[model samples]
Target: MKSKKIKIMILVIFIVLLFLSIGFYIHKHHQDISTDNAIIDGKTVVLSPKVQGYIKKINVEDNQKISAGDVIMEIDTTDYQVKVDHAQAALLTAKAAISAAQNNAIKAGITAPANVEVSKKKIDAAQATWEKAYADKQRMQMLINSGACSQEQFDQAVATEGSAKATLEQMQAELDASNAAPVIIAASQDTVEQLKAEEKQAKSDLAEAENNLQNTKIIAPMDGRITKRSVEVGSYVEPGTQLCSLVGLDLWITANFKENQLEGMHPGNKVDISVDAFPNLKLTGIVDSFQAGTGSYFSLFPAENATGNFVKTVQRLPVKITFDPLSPEDALLLGPGMSVIPTVHLNKGDV
Candidate 1:
């Protein structure tokens, strides 16, 4: 009975020691980051046309791989081309008007100087003739006083001097009128400004029309695969309408690890990925970072805990993990929403 009691006590002590050792080792050594289930996170872009038109051609098909700047589709550009032509015609008309206005300004600026020169020459000639006529009148008057000249000759000299003075006055009036700026002629500057404004407007219209025409031919902005193609040839699509969604090659994983499993989680830690779609393919990545809060915190309707009824729930934080570059063959099967299980090794010493 004594030996049996001793053996029983020894067995109970051994079991207690085993439990204590397990608890101590768990506290010191083991670390892991795991998620329930995750999908391959990838970038996607929506293709939208700026112009509304009938689809003329669909150059790409679903799942077609395209490069940057490649023309994926085209719309009937007849209307756009017509607009461009109209803009060009309007530009030509504006240019012609500008040329005519410039010529008018030049003519107006030169007319005043020419008239002033002619008036000056006439004034000089009139002065010379008046001087001669006055000398002749003096001679005739002196001859008449000595009874050597006729009265008619004296009167003729006086009339010639009067005529020269009248001519000078008329020329002066004409010169003043010519030198003064006319309202119609001075308005050429305003006309030029108006034409220039019209020309600028026409150029802008032309640019807009050309841009619209170019937009008719829809081009891919990035290298991606076409998906969710909705439009077909001869189908009418309006602006802001959905044409297709492009899935970009860049991909990452969003692992929602439990709060308890994130003790040693850090960025730059190595990770192993196993995708459900391509189980045979092994993907390697590194821990990018952890989001500040749970994914549900950013939901459209977040949980309102202000009410008196409250329940404590464990929140799962999202950890971003970025994958290394893989070849086309290896990455062909990976896509957005594809299931993946990521396991992060949190042992810094082992890394």
Candidate 2:
């Protein structure tokens, strides 16, 4: 009975030890889920021309590191320079015309129309004489009818009144003819306004021409390394044609972790990153943020959930990881597009 009991005890001890070992194994490595699908990412700027022209000079080579404001290339500026000169000439001509028009307008405005003023004075004097002669003729006619004055005197008064009316009418015709004098000033003012508009248009054209001339000199927008140069000397390129791409030196990682493993992985959690390029080189970083949606959702062709053979699949969410500054020894060893693996600590490191 003692031997059987001892054997039963030994079997029970073995089962307990096995369970403890399995529990310890799960406790470690379970919290730190890793993925190899992650990669180093950075900003890439594509270089293009704003104005079309033949490539006259190229100052950079493929994969050359360049700084901001550096002259990248020069387009054949002959056409652009000519355009600028033409625009300048046009602007000068417009300004000169405006000056002449303004002078003419001012002259018209300052000088009152003399013809109208002269005609008005003459008409006034004639009207006064006509009124006087008409009154005298009426008085003489009444006197002759009443036999107070001779018929001859009344007839003389009537002739004098007729002559006065004829003179007044002739002078009135001159006044009517002078009414068109004000129209000259109005026409001059209109010409000035027209010249001003043309001047404005010419100024705008000049500005555009100068802008195109400046665009002929292509300059770097930022400090980056140039890659995939597509232009050579004498190559004709148009606006928006991709000349090359500039990749920034700053780098970060985008790690996509499975949905089930994201329970404890949050932003600010410490992470250990390893690039596949240099297996032994390990880097430290922290989780910055989680992407708003899964990578597949933002892809060119997103999956339709209501398809006939739809089956639920676990989605991996991308997490942006910003790395700590590397020592001088490791600074130049990595770049974008390199495969990386990252492990999240789950626990935010001690404060």
Q: Highest TM-score: give the candidate number.
A: 2
Worst 10 residues of 2 by lDDT: 342-351
Clash count in backbone of candidate 1: 0
Candidate 2 regions off by >4 Å? 1-30, 121-177, 327-331, 348-351
Can you give the lDDT of residue 173 in candidate 1?
A: 85
Residue range 1-351, candidate 1, lDDT tens digits: 999999999999999999999977775565566675677888898998899999999999998888889998898999999999999999999999999999998898878667778888887888788788878888888998998978887788889888877887887787777667565467888999999999999999999999999999888888878999999999899888889988888889988887877877789888889888777889889999889888779889988888889987777888889998878977777778888899887763443
Which 10 consecutive residues of model 1 have the lowest summed lDDT? 27-36
TM-score for each of the candidates: 0.75, 0.75
The runs of at least 3 residues in candidate 1 whose Cα sits more than 4 Å from the true structure, single-residue gaps closed, are 1-27, 116-186, 348-351
N/CA/C clash count, model 2: 0
State residue 81's C-alpha deviation in candidate 2, in Å. Answer: 1.2
Q: In candidate 1, which residue pairs clash? A: none
Cα-based lDDT for every prediction: 0.86, 0.87
Q: Write the per-residue lDDT of candidate 2 for residues 1-351, one digit (tens) a residue.
A: 999999999999999999999887666544676888799988888889999989999999987888899999999999999999999999999999999998987777655477778889999999998999999999998898899999889999999999999989999998887776578788888998998899999999999999999998888888878888988999999999999998877778998888887877777888899888899998999999999999899999999998799999999899899888877567567778889999888642332
